[model samples]
Target: MSNSRSTKLHVAMFPWFAFGHITPYLHLSNNLAERGHRVSFLLPKGAQAKITPGAETASDVPFPLHGHLCIAFDQTQDQVQTILSSLKPDFIFFDFSLWMPALAHQIGSKAIYYSVITPVAQALKVPTKQKLEDMTLEDFMQLPPGYPSPSVRIKSKAFEIAQLKVVAEDLGTGMSIYVRITSSMIWSDAMAFRTYHEVEGPYCDYLRKHYAKPVLLTGPVLPETLATKLDEKWTNWLCNFKQGTVVYCAFGSQNKLQKDQFQELLLGFKLCRQPFLVALSTPDGCATIEEAFPEGFQESVKGRGWVYGGWVPQTLILEHPSIGCSVTHCGYGSMWESLFSDCQIVCVPYLGDQILGARLMVEELKVAVEVEREDNGWISKESLSKAIISVMDKDSEIAGLVKYNHAKLKEELTSEGMQERYLDTFIQNLQGLLD
Candidate 1:
């Protein structure tokens, strides 16, 4: 608690290449730096370019891990080893991609695996490379004993390469997600997570029981300030709407939709009849907006619909009083941001972990509603519309309950010392690694 007694560590950080992974790593780095620890954040040159606006990006890591996806991760091994040799930090906190504990072994430095996903995710991640290689869709359906039910049962059709990538089978090559994660359990000096015990205590216990390691939490690692101001045009646009009368829909930077799915979302928004702002990104290999936007769609909803093709300050939009509901992909970052703003969620999860997260928010946390999917898990426009109307209806008891739950969670998240206590525990664990 006292500055003089704090153990200052020279910490090195390397997160996987994605905004969701990068932002939380930065938050931890900033927290460390603020507490008098020395942190050197290592990022591929490409990721360095995409660091969020206003985040401090002046770091010593300049090498680019070139190529796409798993190829890029494959290429970072030697570069990261070189970084470890050069920086000689007390401990290295790296993504679970490269068997980093082995690299740290060669360099005589300790490695800590830092997970940016949820505790349930970590609990369900395969335990070995062999198991990952052998796993089938049915294997996924057969949940481990004590695994949280309903939330953990992923639809079979959702089992695909995109989902595999999250679990660790990259491009049909490279290490499996189990290997990336469990390698940390076996080799890393410790593990750190972006969660609190209160929220996922049971899963956290499950992980420790199974993995046999010190699992440290970082307590959500929420942004200390949501300072990005809304653009004047957006602010002026939203001003005309009545309080809690807007739907704010964003499906993260990565989860792009097919043209048909995109069209269905538009129709759903229209059916709800709330003034809305929707932001979408074209996924790799997806058609551009010019090819995808429906004919007369924009013109028909001209007065009420605002569609942004690229990035927007999502936190600012969610915080606005006009935003009553959010339809999101349930990525950890977006999930927390929406929860932080106390916005009711209409979940349309588009990825693996997202499927689990959406289920938790809806079935367990009771702060969100799920869009109905076909038996094979395809999202329908009717399902989307039904979910939106359910959440947006002012007199609905479900709407009132969701809002109450969101407010309660927000208070717990922002409570003084909740995050700081977790940080202290993590730092103390890092010190233990040194001892």
Candidate 2:
């Protein structure tokens, strides 16, 4: 530990562009700020207007160009060096981009590599990045030889896996997932994951063994408090449903469904006969709800369902007693929130680590199930209905198991000082580095 008696420090945070990545850094910044550390959270220039003020921004390196890994390396190296020179922070936390650690070293700042995705994902994705770009769904399901944990049963349909491969190829970072994560492992002062020991202990151990470095567990850095009130319209609508009867469907901000998939989802909801609320994106140029939704689909389920175009307060909806199960894209944020709210999860993962997350929830945690798909990977309404009913039917075996898992995970998540322990240990390590 540093001989300096003062525990206070200045920390700078920089995250990637996606909402999933940005939100976690914001949460960590909030925690650090509350604990008396000064933080400078940075973002791209245009995004500054979207978030609350106090964000430092670098110029948006125009996309296609922005997506090039070499451009990111140069841009971040200059931008971060500039920030460190101006702020002279004691420590800096950066997202998954590989170039950052060397940038921190060049600028004489201590770097802590933070993963917004799960550690299991980090281990699995890194080794497979190259092969993933070209592998078929069948080849992808066969886990790579060095995949860290065998306990996790790797599974997902062909088309769904294909979707994630496309996403990976589109990544703006110059390096592939393998290059990015392995580079961070070699260069950073330390590493941090957005998970705890209880959920993924073995994978955590495997990472430590492989990297031979100080791997820190940041727990599930969730909001300390939840929304106390919801929109009046939402409140009024939810009041009509009975406790533990409604299925909440949200595919996350980034997921876009094809027209047929969107229609199948609606048809599944209708078939379940469960009062539900589904939120979907109204893609650009779609003028009205009628145009966006399936033909006469809105009319088909008028009283029993509600459809939202965008921006739903998911936490508030989950907290309401009426919510029994969540039909989700299995994003990390959605998974954690579902665990916290004690909502049964029905996963329909669209891309990237979401497939892994869904697999873990279904196989290891025994808390959720993925929707069944046809031979060609098309999700049928019948399959969706079965998955929904399995979780929502209180008297069913799957329902009982899901509730048991939800309660246990919720207890673990909400245990007093679980979040605090992770944050405190992190600060202590940073303070020690000063010595």
Candidate 3:
């Protein structure tokens, strides 16, 4: 393919309904727009409203209903096709809608499978040759053929395997989740991931070899600068604590914990004896976080802890001086944020991709520690507290080592022009696809 430096391209984005997927697409769109590419972003009304203020986010829909949301997304194909015909974009960027490649081809536009998850996670779970339906539990327990990382394997735990099985099964759509994602990858003109080679080169290379196509990396795709500040409420509260003395915990928008697990997590924080802030959805069957709290939990930790069930300014909070540690669910976005922040990292993952991300951090990168789980996937208060203390304790060897490693890696990733160079190369490769 010839490299064309002068041609400007038009791109359209249609991401899965989840916030994790939509937010990254928007960031990539903004990056392209800044580089003088004409872009059109297509999403449902609720997602659009959520991106703007004062409207309910599509995340309000519980996780289980995401399958139905995919069905609805599939139903919008005709409308998407009509828009593509009218707009006539040069490329359509998509994640979950399996029919997108055909639609893009119909409109004479190239389809790009812009994966928001880490390539390692996809490489491990998505089968290369065997039929997804033929995948047995034993197969799920082992690593895929030619998987890049020996350290990253699916946990043998029952719940972990069960979670992987769910991803392979049909989500109310007639197509299994494995088929929906793999077929899209097979048909798309090119593939892309929101990652850099320095962090995930082997995995990306593995994908490139398996798919036999151009695989482009867009770096982390974080905003050049945060346009917003920490809300006053968080600022005031965090300021009261000493520098590097507070722990901030947030599972992403969609992970609702079982009531028992939620209480155990809070109790774990209480045991850590650090000033802490937690933002989480209400537990299953509970109307509010307060309702889900363990008995006398409020009175016991009144001065040192705060729990709220609403959207929070997570990025700003991570930037605060008082936040010494972050307890995260290891979603791709959160993983990047925690890596970039100056905080000690602790992971409590709930999904398959998250499990892989946690392994990459805790085992591969040595930048974070993961909370231990029981055989049934229940996170005990003691395990959570131990993981925090291992990283947060002043004299701990593990704490000092991870901090040193994380800082070195962060410096390289955030070096001047690194992200810009990735985006520039990414654009050139997209343009090459046209040639």
Candidate 4:
């Protein structure tokens, strides 16, 4: 009884302004709350209402969460000092976009960085011979491609690869340099990341030991796939398709398909002769839906296929036995769901980590068939059709292989060893406070 009041773990959860980043933290917060820990998830205004649980409609006086706002992109000495003075989280956790980290440090608060995308630190560092895996660094090992969770294409046109390269140099990649930089500047404490053990094990291992802070790895979370019921007309139509017969085509929240590209995919689905569901949701200019969908394709397929514009309950769709294949942006959430479902993948991944995600799906997982495109990145209808058929054809060897790999990977990830590893890390993080 005393333990309940004595040890109330409090973690302040802050994610970058994106669903992918926010959702995980929400789950984490919920997990913590279920364990009786205090959780405070902050929203910096303009965040979606769907994800935000009971977000206050208006706030006059500054709330604890939105103490002050400073852009991470504008990381200036004076600006940082100003920002730091405002944020006073006890333990600050956020995606990389927020720059108020230096401020948290000034307030003697610990900071932890979660790489919503794969940590590109060493991965992005152009390898000397082949890649970071080939590096002589004992810590270095082969990294399977890093896939991003599906969401809006979060971008900063002002921020380029060149700018990131500069940021890395300024922050220092190694221990001594990073330590010195942290001491001299605003950010305090170290960072952990989320990636699977089998795939990014070597890199994760190195980071766990090298960083001053303990690393937490929670990868490939398999989302619950059945959100809505099957009685709906669309759900009923999906049911008419044979089990493991319908190919699900969805390009996450952030991905956009030009009408031309959308038509190509539509033709691909038609060519496969596989009943399919396509997710088509874009927010304003970020990923607009108007031009991304083939005109009249909806009308043509009215009762034949489904078109989920936004918030289609992906996990539920993936869980359905009628769904056999997926053509996705390779976002982590969708990736794991498909993988765990052990369905065949027909990849048409696009943008940022998705390129790497596609590589992971097609190259590493070896379960998905990638739509071949020109060097300039044009996915012709013919290539799209082939990809669809390759994944959906009942007798296709590739389809069988994909199903098998998915099962195997799912087993490994869900095994006792992985569970032990996570419990150990969580305990250690809790234990660190004793030190």
Q: Give candidates' CA RMSD values in order.
A: 4.5, 4.1, 3.1, 8.3
Q: Could you tell me the C-alpha RMSD of candidate 1 in Å?
A: 4.5
lDDT tens digits, residues 268-380, model 3?
A: 99998899999998999998789999999999988789999998878889999999999999999999999989999998888777877888888888999888878777888
Better of 2 and 3 by lDDT: 3
Whole-structure CA lDDT of model 2 = 0.73
Spell out the clash pairs found in candidate 2. Answer: 67-172, 69-174
In TM-score terms, candidate 1 sits at 0.88
Q: What is the lDDT of residue 302 in candidate 2?
A: 86
Worst 10 residues of 3 by lDDT: 49-58
Top candidate on lDDT is: 3
Q: lDDT at 178 for candidate 1?
A: 64
Off by over 4 Å in 1: 1-5, 52-68, 125-147, 150-170, 283-291
Candidate achieving higher lDDT, 3 or 4: 3
For model 1, give the 10-residue run with minimal summed lDDT: 58-67
List candidate 4 stretches off by more than 4 Å.
1-7, 52-90, 119-122, 126-188, 206-213, 221-234, 282-302, 416-424
